[model samples]
Target chain A: METQDLTIDDCWNRIGIWSRGTEKCPSLADVIHCRNCPVFAETGRRLLRTPPHEGYRREWTRILADEKETKPLNLTSVFVFRTGSEWLGLPAAMIREIVPMGPIHSLPNISSDSLRGLVNIHGRLHICVSIGSVLGIAKRTRNGEERDPAYSAPARLVVAVQENRPVAFPVTETRGIVHFTPEMVKELPVTVSGTKAAYTTGILQLGNLDIGLLKDKPLFKALTKDLK
Target chain B: MLLLLFEIGSDRYALDARQIVEVVPLVRLKLIPNTPDHIAGLMNYRGAAIPVIDLCRLLTAVPCENSFSTRIIIVKHQVENSGEVSLALMANNVTETVQTSLEALPPSGTIMAETLYGGVSGPDASELIQWFDVKKIIPEKDFLFPAGE
Candidate 1:
């Protein structure tokens, strides 16, 4: 029979036959036989029907939908904080409060990063641990570009209730709270560098930026040795 | 017998595989102060706090240079009523795992009760493998203290 006489069902059947046992279906080039067939046009239009959402919306939904399947609702409350130029997040439930930076009694004969002293919060002494030191990142110094007036950011404490007691972490700046579903989180590859991997639970791609989510329990446990 | 081979500086050392619980990546350690020079710090493994001893420092008094290859080998040993205690040994590098016969292993003399040195022969020649007695390195007293405490 002539190709023009072929029906839409015939075109689809031909394509299915060609696709059998192959990784890919027959391309448009192979479907040249159906070019003049009215049924072919109808079949193609039906197969490629656009949903209510088009272009970027369709693309984004497809990506997000796949992510949703893999990462169901693992609700994570993320508290955004700054460590130098990078923006990072820790679990908000893990965090107890955000306190004003105060005099941190430095313990002698310890690593510079290990701020082993206590800080008074609400008339109670809570151990103040420097997040910079715990993550092995350099302490933000006043010299160099940090001295610029535009670069000046107030330091804040991220008080977290760990092991049934309150522990405070010194952060450079607080960027507010974020809630993440499991689908929004991605693990850090073993090769990714910087302070992200050590304390970061995963990275949440929000808009144009990648926000790091901190693994609080593991990080806190690693930093505080004798925490009762 | 099975052996876990790890590198410290240029030298390769082996430990009885039976004592090892698992091998994990080098993690962020909490540095404890007023401790021996060889003790690097403490690492948290599965909710329990464990001390990490720098194997290079404990053996040669010089600290092991930290790099990507650095790893913490978690080892388990039964101690009296404490049942099983887990300790972490930080090695400069982990090369591979090997199995050999005890008959082929040479005796270690004068290395003390805590240290064992064995010889393994390959087709070419023999290499010295030092079996570390992890239990003796960190006494119970030092294990309880946190860094800078």
Candidate 2:
């Protein structure tokens, strides 16, 4: 039979790895992968742009028959922790790491309760600040063995970096990383006081509890200030 | 120098990769009647028709097997009277290229095919590769139908 008689415009299937019982195209080595080859890319474009056949409309109609599935992806990730009795949440991106609560070395002459002292964590000194005092949350200890069972996950210093300076704050208990959708976040209620509401972006609802989503910028600004 | 390597029958051969315009997959061509056995057909290369020479048919009587590795190596070489011509050299198992200068292949070797064959790489080399001069196999007078005519 004449070679012309067996002509095919799509040479890729005939020579490419896609073909059955055919050796892979020699050009594959130079191009490395099929995606890198112009011929392969051109073939894909031609496939999409080719004149529609009888089944073209039928194939597309069948594919488009079903409704698209929508999955509720958790868009916001935050580290939920408790400062005094108030549950606060910070965007996971802002908090660099969390370490076990250590002895805070009080800086001489600086007598602010908020700026507790410097804590040595992994040979690095981080300014340990009491988040409860910084936010002016009243010192009401949940005393006893049954003291906040859910939030009894020991205290840890949340290390966050601002302008290269690392600051560490104590959290009563960390809820680890929580993924929440937009629907779970509610606007700050009017009853939220000035000093407390100033740093919070929104209130995140988790089960029966409400978590104040702290605004990273304003909180960092407040922490860095009154240091000098 | 880089050389596009291919096997003709059992023996491996090479062509200067520098002369190679593009290594295209084997495609169907417009057949030309009364042409020499080595002359495969005219390939439509971007609207312009280019003549393709089947190196296997030229060397051996058998046509190249319809395998994926078998490809048309398009090259533009200087012709005698005509300045430059784009011709396709079809070969089998044209998988990869080798990086070695022609100087590496010593002149001392057996003469398989005189005019078309260039310097043969000595047995001392890792793999014996005979350099096929795409210039010599230009089908000067034998090519009855010149493409673009």
Candidate 3:
């Protein structure tokens, strides 16, 4: 059918999630979700039919009008992540992989609180550890709280390699990569104590908040320290 | 100036990004019969039919390879009498943008007359990039239907 002949079916709102007092769609029993319905997909296509909004070309022209600022050589790249209320980062080179959250099996006779458990990753058994405790960061509290799925990033297992041996650690959610030059690192305060301070070499300036650039040698040393 | 970098055959070309409206991934186009080789086809751009020109075909006589990096750059073309109309440029390896100084770059010193190239510079002192002129690509040659003209 021609695009002009197409009409929107607002049955989703009339019988779907937003239909609180109205009748529920009989298809809802089988389809389960409004997104699964053909009507929903049909309405989504109409978005492409709409013309580009006013000032779109003007805005693009203005943005590209000025010469682009030259970015400094990215000397070091860190994979910044969050845990509880704290924000931490590890050198991108040290991180082996950011795998999806998997089942962590508890081990017997291991009394250390930091050693989480052994996890099977692609047939290889890697010892999972609570890196937060080793770094002195408190347990994440908001993990249980409901978050808007649209905006929230999912938790992932960060597998960091030290030598040939690999270690797995869970993080609330990852913030991708942050690039900075060596000069951008600021000296950490002398008063800072414990493993967090030992592993953190310097503070990397990220906009307003400072990110602790973990010393790869010391941080990985600590992750596998308890076992040895 | 910021430039969009793309490859056509063995040579790499740069286009001034300021004239660009948007860069979209290569989409299936409706072929128009009896048209020139460079004319890719009509694209249903947000309900409006926009004409696309293949940069590879236009320059090297080779159609742009359907690849991941291939894209259609939408721009406002000043068609004579018909006024401003949206035009889509299909090219390959449009993956990166370059930041070059306006004064730092020297003219290519190419002896070819009526060439579409504006400026030329070697990024690594080995690879020479020629800046592609958009105006020359869509000149007042009655490329369109010539109804309003």
**Best candidate, TM-score-wise?**
2
Q: Lowest-scoring 10 consecutive residues by lDDT in candidate 1 chain A? A: A45-54
In model 3, what are the clashing residue pairs, if there are any? none
Model 2 segments more than 4 A misplaced? A1-74, A140-154, B1-149
**Candidate 1, residues B2-69: lDDT per residue as tens digits?**
88888777777777888898776556667888878878886766665677888888877777654434
**lDDT by residue for model 3 (A48-134), tens:** 334333355335334433444467865789999876556778888878898887888998888776898988888889999877777
Rank by lDDT (best first)? 3, 2, 1
Cα shift from native, residue B120, model 2 (Å): 36
Tens digit of per-residue lDDT, candidate 1, span A15-69: 5433443443345455455454445665654433222223443353244224233
DockQ score for model 1: 0.01
Over 4 Å off, model 1: A1-73, A140-154, A193-195, A226-228, B1-149
CAPRI tier for the interface of model 2: incorrect
- For model 2 chain B, give the 10-residue run with minimal summed lDDT: B115-124
Residue pairs whose backbone atoms clash in candidate 1: A96-A159, B32-B147, B32-B148, B33-B147, B33-B148
List, residue by residue over A1-228, the lDDT tens digit for candidate 2: 233233335645666656665587888778766677777665554343233343543453343333434588668899889876788988887789999988889999986667878999999888887777667775435475555543344378899876677899988777888889989889988898787889888899898778989888788778767697
Off by over 4 Å in 3: A1-70, A139-154, B1-149
Better of 2 and 3 by TM-score: 2
Compose the digit string of candidate 3's lDDT tens values, residues B1-149: 88888888767787778778888766667788887888888777766666788989988899987554667888776766677777788887776687776643334434322323333443244566776766665544424633322
Model 3, C-alpha of A111: deviation from truth (Å): 1.4
Whole-model Cα lDDT of every candidate shown, in order: 0.65, 0.72, 0.72
